[model samples]
Target: MTVAERKDISNYLNRPYNIIIKSISDESGDYYVARVLEFNGCVATGETREEAYQAIYEVLEGFIEDMLEDGEAIPEPISDDEYSGNLRVRMPKSLHRDLSQAAKLEGVSLNQYLINKLSK
Candidate 1:
């Protein structure tokens, strides 16, 4: 992936509601077949890996909404091994646009650019 694509992927991955999806495949003599092996219970699987990943997000969103409607406590965010801290912030639209543009110029997504800058 290009740096920009990596950045976008990183941003989405950092979201509290998103989970890192891992899959494994069995290697046949001529071809390999893979399936999603592990995911947070929030996501559901499909016949294909791509479909499973796509469907899981919707499932997760619905699950969360249902929990809220039932008055259950919301779950905490999951962290990746790369990052040690978690913080949430809100920015104005103008600033967000500016930052997003800057990040794109640097071949990164907003979240990744910010994280890379902040980590220095």
Candidate 2:
């Protein structure tokens, strides 16, 4: 869920990366997790959402600092806005037929139906 403006990341350091926050609670009391998906294994957790956010931000800052000190390249976030909105996916003919039928039943175009499903 992180993205810097497409090619306009010159001043992105002031605007923090958008991190993903989710509930990781599983009946062992409430808890939350946060992560910078653009950076593999950069994750943090806390008992509350606010704590998780702060923890993840700290981790992100440290991660960046470490990379800079180590002379490693800092990865920029992948922005979806750069996409052309066109993708060619190859699938079985039967599956395509089924999807077309389903889209027809839902009163929506197949492309729209696929977009809706993928967005969720």
TM-score for every candidate vs. truth?
A: 0.36, 0.73
User: Mind giving the per-residue lDDT tens digits that candidate 1 earns over 1-120?
Assistant: 467745644554446654445554545322212222223456465556666677776665555556555776655554477486777889999998999999999998888999998999
Which lDDT values do the candidates have, in the order given?
Answer: 0.60, 0.79
Every candidate's CA RMSD:
17.3, 6.8
Clashes of each: 0, 0
How does residue 89 of candidate 1 score in lDDT? Answer: 84
Could you tell me which residue pairs clash in candidate 2? none
TM-score of 1: 0.36
Which 10-residue window in model 2 sums to the lowest lDDT? Answer: 1-10
